[model samples]
Target: MKSTLYLLLQIFVLVIFRSDVFCQEAHKWGGQKDGTFSNPVLPADYSDLDAIRVGDDFYAISSTMQFSPGMVILHSKDLVNWEIAGHVVNDLTKVSPNLDWSSMNSYGRGIWAGSIRYYKNKFWVYFASPDDGFFMSSATDPKGPWEPLHKVWDVSGWDDCCSFCDDDGQLYFIATNFKLDPNNNKKYNIHLFKMSQDGKTLLPNTDSIIHQSPGSEANKLYKINGLYYHFFSEVKAEGRVMMMERSQNIHGPWEIRQLNHVNKTVDREPNQGGLIQLKDGKWWFFTHHGSGDWEGRAASLLPVTWIDGWPMIGEVGKDGIGNMVWSAKAPIAVNKALKIQTDDDFSAVTLRPQWEWNYQPRSDKWSLSARKGFLRLMAFRPLKPDDTVRILLRAGNTITQRSMRTKFNIATVKIDISGMYNGQFAGLTHFSTKSYCMIGIKQDGEDRKLVYSSDSQNLIGVTITGSNVWLRSSWDYQGLNRYFYSLNGKDFLPFGNSTQLTWGSYRGDRVGIFNFNRFATKGYIDLDYFDYQYSKQ
Candidate 1:
C-alpha cells in the first residue's frame, strides 16, 4: 500500500507541473527530423535581405529603416540558424540631423534595401537612404568593430544598390533610379555606373541604363559561369515576381525571364532577395514573402536549380518556371538552434545586439555604467506640440526590440523610480505607430502613482512609495496584449485593458522601454533588467 501511494503521489506532481506551463510546444521551423525545414527560417520581420556565403559561413544584411543602428548583419553557418552579429551604422545623426531626437521625422525612410558582399577578404555592406544618400561600411569580421560609415554618393531618387568586381579588376555599381510617375508607379530604370576600385567615387559619364520595368528594384549583379546575372524584382498583375537577366558580357542585349510560383500553395509571392551556393554545391534563394501584413515581411529559404544556363527557384514546373519548395532537405547540416537577442540583465559591458533606440539617442541622456548592472535613462522634454498626448512617441531614448511571431510572449522590466522628478513618466511600452500601451510610474507634484496609459488617456492606479517597481506586457502573434505589474518580484497583477497590437508604415510592433519628461528635462530612471519570454501555443 505504501509503494502504491508513493507512485500515485509522483504521478500527481508531474501532472500538476506540466499543467502550469503557459506556452505550447510548436514547430521550430528551422529544421525537422527528416532533414527538411519549413518556410520562413525566421518568423520575425527581416525585410529586404541580401545574403552571401563566405567560405563555410554565411552572412546577411537587412534594412532597419528608422532604427538607430542602420543595417543589421546576421550570421549563420547552415543558413538555417541565424543570430544578430552586428549593425553597420551606429550614428543616425551621420545620416542627417532630421534623424536625431529633435526632429524625429525619419520613420519608414532611413536605410532601405542594402546589399552585402564578401570582397577583398572583407565583408562589404552598401545601403542607400532616400532622405540622405548612398553609404557603405566594411568589416574584416561580421561581428565588428566595423569601420565607420562612408558616404559613397550624395544623391536621392535611387535605392536597392549592389556592388560587383570583375576579373579585369574593373568595378561597377548597379541600382534603380526610382523616379515615380504621376500614378506613383516606379519609373523602373536599372542603372549601371562605373565606380573607383575603392568604391568611393561614382563616375558621372559612366552611367548606363541596364533595364526598365515596373517596380524594378533589389538589383543584384553576379558573374556566374562566365555569364553576368542581373536580378530584379517587379510587381505584376498576379503579384510580385522575381526577374532575372543574363548576358555573356557585362554590357549586352540581356535575356530576361520571370521566375515565379515555385510552390504556390506555400507562398504565392516569395520575391525580392538574393541567391547563393552552399559548400555542398547546392543552390538556394533567400527571399521575403511579398504578402506582408501585421507581422511584416518574413524571411523564407527556397531551393534553387540551374538548367539550360538559367537559374530556377524551387523546382521546375510544367511552364518552365520553378515552384516553391514547402519543405526541402537542409542545404547545410542542422546545427544548434539560434535566435535574435530578447532578454537583458544589464550586466554586460555593452547593450545586447537586439536593442535599438527609436532614434539616435543623445549621448548625455542614457548610460549603462551610471549605476552598476542597470540601464540609466535620463528624461528629456519631448519636442512635440503637446505633451499631454502620445508623448512617448516623440520622446527620445526609447530602447526597443522586435516582437517575434510566436503564440505567447511577455516582456518585463524592473525600473527604479527614485530618480524620477515631477511630471516624469517612465515605463515599459508596446509601441507601434497606430497604437501603444504603457504601464509605469508617473510623478505629479509630490505624489507618485502607478499608472496605465493607452490611446491618449491615463488610468491612475496605486500610489507607490517604493523605489523599485516591475512592469510587464504580454502578447501573442494574434496581437492580443495585456499590461501587468508586480510590487514584489514574484506576484504580477494585470492592470490595463487588453488592447490589440497593430502595425503601421512598413514596420512591425516593438516592445520598448521609455522615459519622458512632460514638465522639464530633469528626471531619470534606472532599469534593473529586462526579461522576454516566448513560446508557441
Candidate 2:
C-alpha cells in the first residue's frame, strides 16, 4: 500500500507542473499549432518598424510620431510575438516637445523609421525627427535605460537614418537628403557619411554621394560577400522600390538592379525594409504596406536571394510576391496566451501601454488607483469653440462585427456632472479624426439624459433622462456603419448613416468612455466598470 501511494504522488507532481507550464504559454499574442498568422504582429499604431537579430535575440523599434514616450524598444526570440521592452525617452521635452501643427506636421513629428543594430557588445539606434534633426543613442542591453541623444549630422529635411559598422570596425551613416537643390534648389538626394572612430560623431571630411533619386526616401546600406548594396524607395507619382549595387567600396560607382518590387502593380507603395540573414544562411526582408488614409501601414516580410553576388528580393517566379520567409523555425519556447486587455479594472498604478492621446499628453489629465477598481478622469478645456477636450481612449483589436455578440454589462458606472462645462457632457464615444459617434449623459435643466449623436448634425436622436444608464457602441463592417447605445445592453440602435470611417495610422477605431467639460476647471468622473465582451458575430 505504501508503494502504491508513492507512485500516485509522482503522478500528482507531474500534473501540477504541466498545468503551470500551460498557463505561462497562454499570455503571448500568438503561437498556435495551426498555421494561421496574426494580421499585425506589433499592433496599436506602431508603423514603419525596423527589426534586427543579434545572435538568438531579436530587437525592433518603430515610428512614434508626436508621442511623448518616443523610440519604443521591442524584444522577441522568434520574429513574431514582440513585447514592449522599454522606451528611449519618457518625456517629450527631452527631444523637442513644442510642434507647429498648422504646417500639416506636429501631430506626427517624433521619431520616424528608426533602425536598431547590435555592435561590439552594445546596442545602437539611429532615428530622425525631421522637424528637428537626426540623432543616435546606444545602450549595453537591448532592454535599456539608453544613453542620451548623440547628435550626429544636423541637417533639416533629413529622415530615415540607418547605420552600419563594416567588418573592419568602420561606421557609416546612410540617409536621404530632403534639402532642395543647393545649385538650382530643385530636388533631393541620398547621402552617405563616415563616422569617427568612437562612433559618437561623424568624420567632418568624409561626405560622399552613393545615389540620387529625386524623391526617394528610406536609404539603407548592406555588404555581403565583398559587394556593397544600396536600397531606397523611388517615389514617382506612383511609388516604387528600387535597388542599386557596387563592388569596389562603400562609396560606390553603383549600378541599379533591374527588377523593382513595387512598380505600380501588385502593391500601391512599399516603404522601408530591413534586410537580415537567418541562422540557416538564407536571406529575408521585412517591409511595410500602405493603407491609404485610415490605417497608416501594415508590415510584410519576403524572402530574398543572392544571385551572382547581387541580392534579388521577393521571388522571381512568384510574380511580384512581397511576403518573405526565413529558414529559421519559430522559437521552441511558448508565449503566455494573455488576451490584449482593453477593459480597465483600475487596479494598476497607471494606464495600459495600449492607450494614447490625440496630441501631446498632459500629466495631470487623468488619475488612477486612488479609487479601488475605478479610473477617475478630470475633464479638460476644449481647444476649439464648438468642441470639448475629447479624452479619447483606444478601442482594442477584438472589436470586429463578428466579435460583438459577447455580452458585457457596464450599468454600474457612476458619473458626477455638477462641475462640468455649461454644455459639457460625459459618456462613451467611438471617435475618428474625420467622424465620430457618441451616446452620452448631458445635463438637461437639473437632470441627466442618455443622449445619442453622430457627425451628421443630429443632436439627441434618442434620449433617456436618467442618472443610472448603460451605453454600448459597435461597428458593422458589411454595412460600414455603427450602432449606438442600448438601454439593456442587448438591443442596439443605429444612430446615423454608415460611419464609413476606416482604420488609419493603425487599425481599429478609437472607442472609450470620455468627458468633455469645455471649462478649464477640473471636474471628475467615476467609472465602476468599462467591460467589453469578445464574441463571434
Candidate 3:
C-alpha cells in the first residue's frame, strides 16, 4: 500500500507539470512548482546547521568560521527556499585578532557548532569556538542589529553547545568538553549549567555532568509531552550516529537510545542539525552531512515522526531507526524559486551580502566608494609572504563568493587594470583552498601578460593590448574547472589548462577576485561587475 501510494503521488506530480520541467526540477535544488522539493535543499556549503520558525519566516544560521561577520543567518518563507538574513558577529575582531586579515590564521578553526532558540520574546544564539568559549547573541528581529557576542564562558576546549528554556521559566545551557581537564583525564562529557533567564550569564555552582559518550556533541534540548528529550550525536564503534536521551527531570537518571546507525555515504554523514516543531505541530529536522567535500555540509530537511514521545527523523524503519531522506513533500504550500545573490555591479551602498572577504579585511585597503560604481581593491603584500613562492593563497585582499554546484557554472568579472603598478597580480580564480586555479593579468613595465596559476603549476599566457580585460571561470557539477579571458566583453577565449576544484578548510570552492603585489604595495585594480550563472546556458 505504501509503495502504491508513493507511485500515485509521483504520477500526480508528473501530471501537474511537463515531463522535462519535472525532470529538471527533480534534479535541481529548492521548492518545485508542483509542491515537492528536492534534497540537499541547499546544494552549496552551508555547514553546521541550526534552524527555527518565527511566525511565518523560517530562519537558519550556518557556521562561517574564519570569515568576518561571523555566523551566516538565512531567511526563508518555505523551508526549501532560503536567503541571507544577516550575520551574528558583526566585527569578528571583537572575538579575536587571530581571525583578522593581518594575522593570517584560523584556516579551519573558528565558530564550530551551537544552537538557536526563541526565548523570552527574543532570538538567542549560542555557539562554541574551539579556542574560545561559548558566545551568545540575541535580536528581536531575525535580520539586523543583533546584540554583540557576549562571552558566557571563558574556558576553551568546548565544542557543540545548546540552550534550553523550561516551561517554568528556568534556563539551561549544555555543551560538550572533548578536551582534558586539570587532571589530564580524557573527558568527553556533556555539561549542563543553569543560566539566567535574561540570557545574560551562567549561574554559578549549577554545572552538572548530564551525560558522557565517546566523541559526543551536537546537543539539542526540548521539553515535549512532559518529558525532556536531549538530542545529540556520538561516535560509536560503528561511526557517528544520532542519540537521544529522555528523562522526567532535566537532570540525570535518563534512558538513552540510538536514533540512527548508518553512514551509507561515509564522508557525508547526516549527523549535526536543528530540530524544529512547525505551526501545524509537525516536527522537522535540518541536518548537514558531517565531513565536507567541494560541496561542504549542504543542508537537508527531513520529516520527523513522533512515536511514543520519541522524534524519529527521516524515514523511520520497523526497527524504529531512521534513515536519511533525499526528497520529500514541502512543509508548507508556497510557490517561490529561491536563489542566493550572485551578480554584483558594485553599485549598492554596501557590499552585497553574497560577498565576503577571505578574512577580516584590512579596513583601508578596499573601497566601494573610491570609484563611482566599481569595487577598488588596493594591492598589498601578505603579512608573511612565502619567500620561495608568492601564491594567491597568501594574498590578504581576495574578496570571494561561493561557486554553485550545479549542472554548469560560469563566473565572469570585468576588471580595469590601467591603475595597476608593476609586480601586481590581479584576476579571477577558482578560490579553492586545494588544487586551485586562477587566471590573471600580471603587471610588468608597460606590458601586461596573462598568467594562469594553480597549486601545482603557473603558466604565462598572451599579453593583451587593452587595459580592461574580462576573466571568466566555468565549472561543472563534477567540480572540473576551466578558465577563459576576453579583451572584449562579447567574446571569450579559453586561456588556461584544465584544473580541479577542491573544497578545503571546511568550505566550498569560491569564486574570488584577488589582487596583490609581489614587489611593493603600490598597485590596485577596479572590478566593475561580477556576473554568475549555474543553469545550462
| Model 1 ranges off by over 4 Å | 1-28, 182-185, 262-268, 385-387
User: What is candidate 3's lDDT per residue for 1-537, written digit by digit as tens?
Assistant: 999999999987775753322222444766666778776777778888888888887888888887766888888877887878778887777767788887857778777788889979999999998887889999998777898779888878888889999998999999899877699876699999999977768899999989998888999898888999899998877678888999999997899887765563432567888888789999888888776667666777888987777888878988998877767889988536556778999998788877777778888999999998999999988765564243666677888887776778899999999899888888997765554678999888778899988766878899877879999998876678899998989899998788767788788887889998887888889999999987621
lDDT of each: 0.82, 0.56, 0.81
Q: Count the backbone clashes (under 3 Å) in each candidate.
A: 5, 22, 0
Off by over 4 Å in 3: 1-27, 180-187, 264-267, 387-390
TM-score of each: 0.91, 0.74, 0.91
- Name the candidate, 2 or 3, with the larger lDDT value: 3
**For residues 61-104, could you state the per-residue lDDT of candidate 2 as single tens digits?**
76666543567676766555556676665555555645211111
- What TM-score, to 2 decimals, does candidate 2 have? 0.74
Candidate 1 structure lDDT: 0.82
Best by lDDT: 1
lDDT of 1 by residue, 1-537 (tens): 999999999988865653321111233455667777766677667889999998888889989888878788888888877889889999988877887888887777888898998877888888898867889888899888888889999888889999888878777899988886898766979899888988777887999998988888989999998999999888777667888999998887899998765222236367878899887787889887665545566787988878888888877888888876656788877776666678899998888899889988888999988998999999988877285566777888799888776667888899999999998988988877777888889899978998888886779999989989999898865667899998897899999788877676667788899898877989899999999987621
